[model samples]
Target: MATQREKDAADYLQKHQIMELFDNLTSMLFFYRPDNPREFLVEQLKQLKLSKQTGVNQQNLFNNSNLDAVIRILDPANQSYITYAQYKHALTTLGIKDINESPEGVHEDKISHETFKSEAIEGLQRCSSTYIKSDV
Candidate 1:
């Protein structure tokens, strides 16, 4: 049986249309086999041409700082690499409130592959929706 938290996470992902994004990303990763998912994400953001459409600087969205942070978070084990699960977890936790500080006493900002993917997925969905709704 799924835990209440798991169910809630699923609900959140479904509510925000993040599942679609996750599925698409998963498919792309399976086919592309990028050496570094974090780098791949940066590349995707650049290819999105979001800055051109919204008049915001692309550097703000796909910079070395952000990529480094993501890489660190996604590979909490310090294994110098990440698996698909780690990638998904990092993406899912992107916008979840207090997820790093749940009543269960989870640590905030401590990157772990065990982190739920729905959390980060929510963040990605929010970004996607925001771009879609922008005047671009």
Candidate 2:
């Protein structure tokens, strides 16, 4: 029922995963609540483009602040750790698929702040690389 132009637009967006990009951008904007959201988004997009072009881990979205915020969100009680299940869920939400039973620095069912930060960084970097390669 869509016009040709509309269909083409939808196809283009799907091909480039624009919606997914927007979803991530919006999520970060809300979580970080930067005073200059326009600037923040611009910087994130620039980093993504750079990463895609050079295959470098230059994206600022996976910085320590954002990762720390993610950990805090997952650990609402400030228990200094999240369960393995919680960590997996967090990774899944970030579009990271592959998960090991136990990554370095993480033990048992508890994912401490340092462990979560380290694991999340690696997972996010992998996801970013995969996304860049596939989308290109």
Candidate 3:
């Protein structure tokens, strides 16, 4: 029931929305570091902020048992560093089938610098309400 132009516009919007989510998640996971940022420390996951309204308790999200299982799946080398590729693989292993396709239009293990920059700009635009000037 949609015209071709409207369908194209909707698709474009959805693509950009997914890209934004990917950019934000990547930034959070990698701590905004892009130099050799292919991997992240397991400890980083523990530092994520959780919302109480989500009803997901810390015991379930950050439990030692859960961490150990994830580590086993993501860090087979036991090196404590989980690569982006491994993380994606872990998601797939956990029944996440739509994990590989990235907003970049190709499957990639790590986010590029350009993507990070765009995400930063968008973050700044949304900062007035959520962040203080001093936080910058």
Candidate 4:
């Protein structure tokens, strides 16, 4: 049986979206592999604070730079594209769950970086709005 304190801690984490925040932080850290992770984290946290203060919905927490990094990581051969499956996996990793198909005119078998970015941006916005709706 779980203790009350443990249950409360879990509730707190979920309520504050701490786990999702940590997941994004860890993913970005690994993707960048920066020389100074602490400094990187500080910048990211500052952005997060600014966004929150501005009432910006950033639940999915993805940016153009991160999207580009994801494409590069998935397309290790410098092909400038990734398989549809890889694109889907990348979206899932970025906490984007609402996008089931590529953006219009994108080939499923060979998704270009631009197409992926479009779909990712759409999905991120949708997911962030969903969070806002749920919270209200």
What number of clashing residue pairs does each candidate have, in the order they appear? 8, 0, 0, 0
Q: In model 2, which regions exceed 4 Å deviation? A: 1-55, 104-107, 130-136
Q: Whole-model lDDT, candidate 4?
A: 0.73
TM-score of 3: 0.25
Q: Estimate candidate 2's alpha-carbon lDDT, on a 0 to 1 scale.
A: 0.75
TM-score per prediction, in order, is 0.29, 0.54, 0.25, 0.56
| Tens-place lDDT digits, model 1, residues 1-136 | 9999999998876665555445545654665789998788667555435754765433222334555677776665676545544554554454333333342114343333334333444344344443342232
Off by over 4 Å in 1: 1-7, 45-136
Q: Candidate 1 vs candidate 4: which has greater lDDT?
A: 4
Clashing pairs in 2: none
lDDT of each: 0.50, 0.75, 0.41, 0.73
Which candidate gets the maximum lDDT versus the true structure? 2
Report the C-alpha lDDT of model 2 over 22-119, residue by residue, as the tens digit: 76677778878999999998887877777788878674356888788898798889998888888888888876778766865456688788887877
Best by TM-score: 4
Candidate 4 per-residue lDDT, tens place, 21-75, comes to 6766787788789899999988877667756666676445568897878787899
- Identify the runs in model 4 with alpha carbons over 4 angstroms from their true place: 57-90, 93-95, 100-117, 125-136
lDDT of 4 at 80: 74
lDDT for 70 (candidate 1): 76
